[model samples]
Structures are given as structure tokens and as C-alpha cells.
Target: MTTTIRSVETFRLRVPRDNGAPTERFRAAPRVRSIYPTADELLLVRIATDDHVGWGEALAPASPEAPGALIDEVFAPFLVGVDIAAGARPLTRRLQQTGRERGHLSGIQADAIAAVDIALWDLFGQVTALPVKTLLGGANVDAVPVYMSEVNGASAHAKAATAALLYERGMERFKVHLVGPPEIALAEYDVVRSEVGTSRLALDAHWVHGAGDARRLARGLDERGAWFLEAPLAPEDVDGHVRLAAYSGTSIAIGEAMRHRFEFAQWAGAGAMAIAQPDLGRTGITEAISIATIMGAHHIPLAPHHSMASGIAYAAALHVSAAVDDLLAVEWGPRIAERSDSFLDVAFLEPIGTSGAWIEGGVVAVPAGAGLGIHVDEEAVRRLAAG
Candidate 1:
């Protein structure tokens, strides 16, 4: 039976916890910025078909409230009662068309559609009784490597301590976010590089520097054997990224800010990006796949972003990562995940434990079963939903 979308509901989940864990880690290193929120709220999109249910999440860091309203006000009205079993392609095209006409093709508009599109795909997978990885053909790797992302800290010593903890836990790949002068960032990088023992390292400057500084920072890290220099320039400056990527020969990772594949094509075609990090909460599964396919043609690896999302989106990313050929590693947010009010559980292959993301091994396995391959507690989601 072809399933029609019955309803679309967005639940805002916020849970209470110490939230100060990461902050305390940065207590001595005062210059480090906090990218992960304390007491973060996630907007979960739930789409129910005649019989099956599907789940999705919007990337609402800092607990932005606009995407949920956009879903209720705009996306739901258009998606409800639509037979999505044919695939979410047409509807997504229509939604983007509508957004273009209304001048909201990016930002919140894109985010709302992203969540809706993910739910639609989850519904499709459930109907077929196959994991999404299988639905997207088959996985290229059995388990994708995981990368721990966090504020590397204020001082070099502080940075080294954090790296030491993660390294002891078996995490070899890391993306460290550092703020302040390029020199300060380099200092922390040097200490971490020394402590981590020839491990893979990437730096995210959080758009704190420009092409010149990014060039300098890239050179410093390159000389020291860093994997990639990420987001040194602001996300909108594609040309700047292109120049840096070309000049430094260091693969630049971008795409968390990008909403669709067309944007990624612009970056990849320009040779601006070496790795693409589209957030599933922003591009969702449909466009994330499309973007990955575009990047794959360019031989760019996909390292899907996962800053502050809950477990639902993480599970979704695992399936997509497992399906792709050139996959680096999914960014893990132990800081955010600890208190993000993510509520989902399902029996999965323990090829890796802990939501298929084994922190100890720095590798995450694809969750098995149908749809998004997790059981969501909708009732708990509603209760946890913030006002």
C-alpha cells in the first residue's frame, strides 16, 4: 500500500543536566569558545503515514525556535496527505520551488524541509523493510570511523590534557575547535599533535579568521602534518576557501552551513572543499545523499556534521555514512549528546556498542533494521519538548 503522510509534528526536546561539563573542561583555558550548548534543545520532526512512522531532526543549536514554526506553518500544510511512497523527490523539489518563490530557499526554510525530507525517507525505508543503507544500494564499509569534536581548550597544556583523555579512550581522529590568534590555535595544535602521537587531527577555526590567516594557519598545520584545516574562512566565502584549498593543498571541510547539493557543487567544482560535512539536520537525508553523490564525483570524501543533534539524527547519519564510498568519519558530540534530550533506542548490531558509535574505537557501525532503525519515544519527546 502506498503510504500518504498523515501528520507532521515537531517536538522540541530539552533536558536538564550539568551542561557545565565541557565548560569546566575549558575552565583553565578561558579563550576557548563553546560551540556545543549546555541544556540544548532539538526539534524533532515526526511524520506518520497510514501505518508506519518516521523520524527526523532539525539542526537547532542554541535552541532556535523558528524551524519548528516553519514546519507547522509552511511545510506541514504542503506535505500532509501527500503520498510520499513514490519518493520525497517531487515534494522536495516543490518545497524548494516554494521557498525560492518566497525568498527562503536557505536558512530556516531549508532546515524545515530537511527534517521533513528525512522523515519521508525514514517512512520509505520502513515501508520497504530494509535499512536505509541497503535502500541506498549497499554500504561501502562495514563501520565508519568516528571523530571526537570539542573545544581543544585555552592553553597548550589544556589542549593536550583534553587530547590525552580522548586518546586514552581510543579516539584517534579528532576535530579541535580553537579560538583567538592563529598562533594560539597553532600552539594548542602543536601540543595536541605531540600528545596524540601521530593521530589524525583537523582544525575548525569557527570562521574566526580570513583567507590570509587561514592561509597562515593552514601552512602551520600542514607543516606539522594536520589532516585538514576546516572552516577558517566564513562559510559564505566560497572563493576564499577555493584560494586557500588550492594554495595550501590542505583539504578544507565545509557544508554544515550549506542547505543543498547545488551549493556543495559550487564548492566541489571550484575545488574549494576537500571534505564535505553536510549536517543531516540541515540537508536531511535526501539532499545529503545528493550532495555526497556530487562530492563523490569530485572524489571529495563525505564527513557528515553532527554538532548538537540528538541520537535520531546520529543514527540517520550512520546509515548514510555506511552507504557512501569516500567517507571519512562522523563528528561525535559527547558533550552535547549527554544532555541534548535525545530519546531513541533499538536493537542494533553491536559490531559497535553505544548507539552504533563506539567511542573507545573511534568507529561507528550502521544500525540495522527498518526505517531510521531506532525506536523513538514520542510521548517522552513531547514531555521533553520545550515551550
Candidate 2:
């Protein structure tokens, strides 16, 4: 009995705005211009075998210039009519291997592969009647710690206020997204650190700075007491990161934009990153676990990244975080945390501690249920899918 990939449905979920107001934090006031009109464009793939249905979401940018189109037009066609249970790993390997020659690491192809990979895992879990963490080697904890990710809003003051609010809500770890010059980022970091008060303040430079600039900014941040500096240089700048990590007391965190476990292996082997932040959406559970294992071998902590695509991605991250031995707290976007309940009809999973620190006294837990252990609100997915 083979589990067949019956069909693939690709659709866009535009979180509608009321009266042109920001529908969510990603779209809220003093718009950053770069992150607005946020939409949850996903490719929902349904695989069936023996009365079992497995759902997967491929989250892509709303813009045509981006990679979502590749997932819809290119990847979906390859996945149709295949047996998911038996063929998923082979298909993923083939897709990745084929993509390597074409230099297709990021974009629609990656997103599409990720969607199918995740769906296959979900299907596998459902078929086995086991949660993903159990499949990965059982749960290590009950819930994973979460850090509040800052929105790229217009005003620094408003963003700082938002950070403070999250801190008040039991978030100990906070990260401010850096989109501009080092000085501008430094100032914003200062505001948030002052607001949150020197606990676990991290800055994600988003690969916007060069080595020299990163060094200068990192030195300044070290003085101000930042826990880590993330993606200060471009993803390809492994040497730059290694140098920055060596020079600054701030731990260098990378790997979100990077795909594949081997990429993380190289980074970890080279001591390029002190923290390995892999997005399960991009790497999938299999590859993410591989990355985490590699990072664990190097004694590096795995901190998965989360965003506002669906609960699937978040659940996937949680499962992975629970299984990894050297797991650090995962990144949780407050934007998603605030609106996840409204978007999806499920209990707010777990309270990421106040002030952005997820691991209280150095311990975190994973959510327990069946499959990913998250109850997906099919109604919400349907409503967003309808729109």
C-alpha cells in the first residue's frame, strides 16, 4: 500500500486590512516599506493513502519577482501523483541535487521542496500515530523558549515600545532587525536594550553589514551588552563572520538564509557561527535535524527561526527544538505570537517566558499532541485560503 500524493493546491492568503489600517504588526503603522501588506501565500499539498490526509504549506513572498511562482509552476508539477511516504526523501534529494547545478539554493524551488518535505514529515507522523519529535527521537522538553523578534517599523520609538510590551508579556530575549547603517542599528539596539534592561538582547543584522562594519558595530554592541550578533555579514562571508566572532565578544549567529545541513556543517566546522539558526520552513525537519546534529557535534546551540506563515512551520520548529540536545531557545516573532490565535483556531501553544528569554533557568519544553502536536484551525486556513 503506497501513500500517493493525490493533489497539490497552491493559493495565496492575504491577511485583509480593516479600513486600510495595518492588518498585523508586519503591516502596522510607520510602515518600514520593506515589510508591509504582509500576505501568507502558501502551497497546500494534500497527500493520501489508506484514508490518511497530510497537509503541507509552502510560504512564499506575494511578489511575482520572488520565488513563490517557482513553487507553484515548477515544483508542484514534479510532486503530483507521486507516493509521498516512499518517494519523499528520494524526490527531495533529486530536487536538491538538480538545483545545485543550477545554483538554485534560495527562492521558489527551495520553498516548494520545503513545502513537500514538511508535508511528507507530517504525513509520516500521522501515518505512524506519533508526534514529529517522537519520530525524531522523542521529546527532550515540554516547550521551547521563544525570543521576541522586532518589526521593521518606521519609528524607532514605536518599535522600542513594542519591544517593551513583549518584555512585559514574559519575553526575556529580544532581537531588533537591522536594515540600515551600523550606526542606525546601534541606536535602535540601544533603545531596545535600555527598554528591556540588559538580559538577553540580540541583534539580527540581516546580512546588511560587511566584515569591517560588522566588527565596528559588534564592538560597540559588546560594550552595550548584546548576547549575540546575527548575520552581520552576508551568508557567503564565512571568513568575515569567523573574524567578527573572534574579534567581538558577541557570539556570531548565522544559517537562517543558508540551506542544507552541509552548509551549516561548514559554518559550524569553521567556527563561523556560535549559534545555528535554521528555519525549518527552508531546511525541513530532516535537514534541520541534520544541521542540529552537526551543530551539536560542534557543541553549538541550535536556535530555529519562526515567522508568520502557518502553525505548521512553528510546530515543526518546536519539534526540532525539543529533540536537539544542545538546543538553545528558538526565535519567535511577537507579530506571529500576538495574532497566531486569531489566524488559527488553536490554544496559544506555550508562554515564551517574559522578557524574550525562552529557557528559564536554562530549561525549555516542547508541545505535546499527535503529529506536530499543534491543532491546526482548518477553518482559519480555509478562510485565509478563500480570501
Candidate 3:
């Protein structure tokens, strides 16, 4: 049986945010927080190995069309001839080799490589009859612990209400997205507290400050028993983060925008962040695991930045977090009954042996099925693909 990859296929899904109309979700938010988020876009890649099928996705937060074009014109042409059995690590190197000649893979180029590398790993797991995590290393646990992501709304009450709703649905922890100055953040934290009542809440500042503001907010979060503070300062300011970390009582989290291990190494070496959040779709499985190893050396936990990704990308993130020794819970965006118009949901993680959704009671199980352990609908993908 020829398990070598035969063809490459791609998809681009443009799901408008409520048909590009204003809604209570936005009108009720603390402020017009998101700057015209017209839609949520995703790019998916599929690889075939005679007997098995595998899926992957690039984290296309904005325009998937660009990465989609690059995957078709650039990466797919390079990878279609490769062997899945040859291995994901080397195949990743083969992809990066192009960047070495042309330019470093960043932005959409990095995303394209990620989609290809992840699909290769998924195919490898299918051929070997082992889950992707098992291939990386044993899944230290059956279910990867997760924290329910944001519940944004116009008012503090709205945000708290949204969090309460997810908690009723079996989520135990939450992350409140914050923007603006320190006073604005502290007030919202109080709102989150009044509603959730200290049930494991974390604050994502979204790069809202300098050393002084971050220290003030971190001090407040620590007093309230908040889990961690993310991106208090700019992404590249490692020394600034190190300075902030010295005074802040809360753990500092970072690495969502970073492209490689070297950047993470710089931050980790400086003891900047207590937790590292590497995006699986951005790093590809190859560099992501390497980044994990780098973070591990500094005794920093990897929480994995995950959002705007379809189920395929989420599955990849879960598998990596499962394999790594240090995971401080995965980030999940349930969106409180938000639209499910994207075809990506058709490929949600379906546990082979588990009874309920992969997510059950504030935790998600590492899918036991071979490969990424999810079912992707080919017909749906083709319909969603851009020309």
C-alpha cells in the first residue's frame, strides 16, 4: 500500500460575523473592543495517503485567501511528492529549506508550512495506528485541561453573564479579555469577579501596557487570585517584560505572535514570562515541539495560544499540549452560542473511545483515534474553497 502523499487540497472559509451586521454581542461589549472584525476566516489543507486521509489548518485570523494561494502556488507543489512515512520532522525541514533560499517563512508563508506539517503528522499517525500525541510522546493524560476563553460584551454585566452561561455548560475556568488603561481593566476584573466569584479566572491584557501599568494590573490580578496576565507589554520587549515580571505577583504569559524558538528562547532566557503560548498552526508541529522543549528548560509552562482555528488546528494544539510535560490548560473560545456557519466545525475532534464531545466538564480528552482524530467533510471543504 502506497501511503505516500498523493495530492494536496485546500479550503478557504469566509464566515461573516453575523452577516456583517451589528448585534447584541457587539453592542453590549464594554467598548467597541474589536476593530471591525468583519468575519472569521480559515484555511484548511488536506493530504491523501492512498488508504488514509488527514487534515490541517493555517491560523488565518484575517484573510485566508493569501495563505490559500501560497499553499497552492508554493507549499503544495513542494510537498505533494513527499512521503508521509518519511516523517513530519524531515518534511518540515524540507519546507523550511525553501524559506532558507527565498526568505524566512513568516506571516502567511509560516501559516502555509504549518498546514502542511500538521497534515503530514496527522497522516503519520493514521499510518502507524497511533495518535499524534503518542507519536510525539505518550499523552501524559487522557484529557488536556482547558480554560474557557473570552465572553466579551458591551457592559461588565454582559461579560459576566456570558461567563456564567459557559460555566453552566460545565466550564470551570475563564479568561477575560481586557483593553484600555489599568483602571479600566481593574474595574472589569471586579465585574468578572462579581459574576464568576473566583472560579479560576485569568486576564488577557492583549498588549495593553508598559512596565508600570502591567505591574499595577498584575498586582490587582494577584490580589484577586487571577491565574495569569498575558501580553502586558509589546511582544518584542523581552527586557521590559523581565522588568515587569520582577515586580508583578502574577505569572506573565506571552508568545502568541512570535515565529520561532529563538524568540521564545530570548523571552524564556530573560525569565520574562511564566507561561509560553505557542500557536500550533503558526509554528507547525515541528517548531512548536522544539519551542516546548525550549520553554521546558526554563521551567516555564506552555499554555498554547489557540483561537480562530478550526477543529483540525485545535486538535493539533491539543495533541501537542498533551505530549508536552508542561501545559497550563488550553484556551477555548466557545463564544456563547455564536454562529456555527463555518465548515471547519464539520471536522471537530471526535474521540475514538470517549462518550461525549471531546470537551467534557472543563477538560478535553486527547483524541485516541489515529492521526488528528477528527472527521473533516471533503464536500463541505470544496464548497468553501476560494477559486
Candidate 4:
């Protein structure tokens, strides 16, 4: 069945989570507040073929409406009548060309392009009857390791409670997002470590600290015997990262803001980060696989980042991690598990023994079956869109 790209339809699907309650930490960031009231804010992209339909979602901006606008106003027009077989490269090239004169690649445009790239890959997977991981070159290991990401909250207790629940669910490896002052953040980590033990803990500063602060915090985390310290300094401060990475005993993890393989090459060659954390949604499969190769040459491990985007992004990350020989683990957010499953058709084959959660052994088995090996619940997506 030869499939011709008919038209690309983009829309916003807002499904409510927690009965419109403000239970999640990052939900109130003003940009995502409306989504809190609505439950879910997904940017949906539909790729139609003569005999099949493919669906994809964007990571969406903090703003409830930006993702949809990005797709409809910018991406959809450029992609509507294109050939899907050309794959993501052509679409990405067009996006780069359109944004070339804009001087930066860090806003709605990147997000929109990412959405289209993901949808195209899903379409490609469906067309070929192969999982995306196999399409990217198959897996070194059947499953990728998973590290639980923290829930944003005001208090250490709240964060600790969330961590404890995940621990009980069988996740031995964990990373917490530190939002407050350095001391406060340290205390939060201490509490979590006390509960989950030091060996399983890692801290993500989210580029929140300066060089000096990052150096100090990295040292502190090392003293606690934590596995690694992630994105402690600002994204562009390569020198700062190099210096901190040099002085700190804990391994440094960075690279989610980096969009292409060259940026990752620079960081990996410079020995700036011990673990490279590229986002599949932001980098797409092409650049991500390239980045993984570059990291492999330097003996650095690739640990792809997965945020609150839809399952497509998560599946894309899984595929990349599965293909990389030097992959360590993939990051997973519990919030996504709690809220996104209903809208996705084939959920991430639960990790084995976590009771509806990705298995806790740190390794996630590559999904089997065709095309991302998952399906979208179109009805549920449409319901959210209607709301």
C-alpha cells in the first residue's frame, strides 16, 4: 500500500487531569496554567495516508496555546502536501530554512518542527511495519534503563513523598528537580536520599546555578555518593560546565537545549558532560542518533530526556536509547504516566514489574511491533480536542 501524504491537520487537545486541580508543580508556570484547569494540553498532528492515519504530539510550550499555533500557522502549511517518504530530513530542512533568518532555534518554531518530524517518523514506522528503534538501527539491549524524574513542589516533604511512592513502585534510580535556593535544594536532596538511600539519588539543577554554585553543589552531591549531577550550570556556559565537571567527583549530565549533533559534538569533545541528555523531540531521531554516535566515540553515555510531551516523544527517546551501544538510561516522568496513557493507543509496555509503571530495574525493553510500536487513541485525542 503506497501511502501519499494527503494533508496535515493540527489541533490542540486539552484533557483535564485531577479534576482541574493544581496538583503538579510545573503546571502553574503561567504558560501551562490553562492546561491545569483543562487537564491535558496536547498538540496533535494527523498525517493521513490513503489507507492509514498517523498521529503525533508536541512537547508543547508552557503556554496552553503555543503548540497548536506553531503547528497550524507555521508547520502545517509547509508540510500539508509533502511526501512522507522523504522523511524528517526534508521537513527539518524546510523548518531550518524558514527559521534561518530568525537568528535562533529556541521557540515555537523548533517545537512545531519537532512535532512534524515525530509524526513523520511515526508514519514511516507504520508504513514499514517496523518499530522506530529497528528503523533507527535496532537495539543493543532489549530494554533501556529508566530513572524517575521528580515532581515540582514547594516543600521537601512533598517532593520526598512523591519520590517515596516511586521508590515503592520499584524505581531504584531517581533524579530530583531542585527549584529553591542552594541550601534548600540540598536539604530536599538529603531528605530524599535518607528515604531512598544515597546510591540511588541524582540532582538536576536545571541550569539554575552559576559556575561557582554548581561547583559547590556538585561537590556536595558527590559527597553524598549520588550517581551524577545534571545540568547544573546555564546551558551556554560550556566553560563553566567544563570547569565544574573537572572539579566535581560526580559525573555531569547536560545537553537538552542543544538542537543538533554538532553542539553535542562540541560538548562531548570538550569533556564538558559525562552523560549526554539529548531530547528526542528537540533533536529528532536523525540528529539524536548522530549525537549518540558522537558521544559513543568519546565513551560518554547517552541518556535521552523525556518531558511532558505525548507518548510519541517518549517512544522516540526509547528508540534512540535502544539503538545506542553506550546508552545508560532514559528519563521518565511519572506525570506523563498518570495523565497521558488514556490518549495513547498502545501505552509504553509497562516496564514489567512496576504495577502499570515502567519496570524499576532501570532498563526499559524496546517496544515490539510496527512503527513506534504504539498506537494513538484517536477518539480520546478528539475528545480532548473538543474540550
TM-score of 2: 0.83
lDDT per residue as tens, model 2, 239-288:
88888878988888887777677788888888788999888777777777
lDDT of each: 0.77, 0.68, 0.77, 0.73
Off by over 4 Å in 1: 20-38, 151-154, 340-342, 346-361
C-alpha-based local distance difference test score of model 2: 0.68
Q: Which candidate order results from sorting by TM-score in descending order?
A: 3, 1, 4, 2
Off by over 4 Å in 3: 19-36, 101-105, 335-361
**Per-residue lDDT tens digits of candidate 3, residues 81-126?**
6778867889887777787745445666788888888988998888
Error of 3 at 56 (Å): 0.7
Number of backbone clashes in candidate 2: 20
Residue range 305-337, candidate 4, lDDT tens digits: 876666767877887788888878888775666
TM-score of each: 0.89, 0.83, 0.89, 0.87
TM-score of 3: 0.89
| Model 1: per-residue Cα lDDT over 207-317, one tens digit each | 778677788888888888788887888778988988898888667888888988889999899988898999888888778888888998999999999877777778778
Question: lDDT for model 3, on a 0 to 1 scale?
Answer: 0.77
Scanning candidate 1 in windows of ten residues, the lowest lDDT window is 24-33
Residue 249 local lDDT, model 2? 89
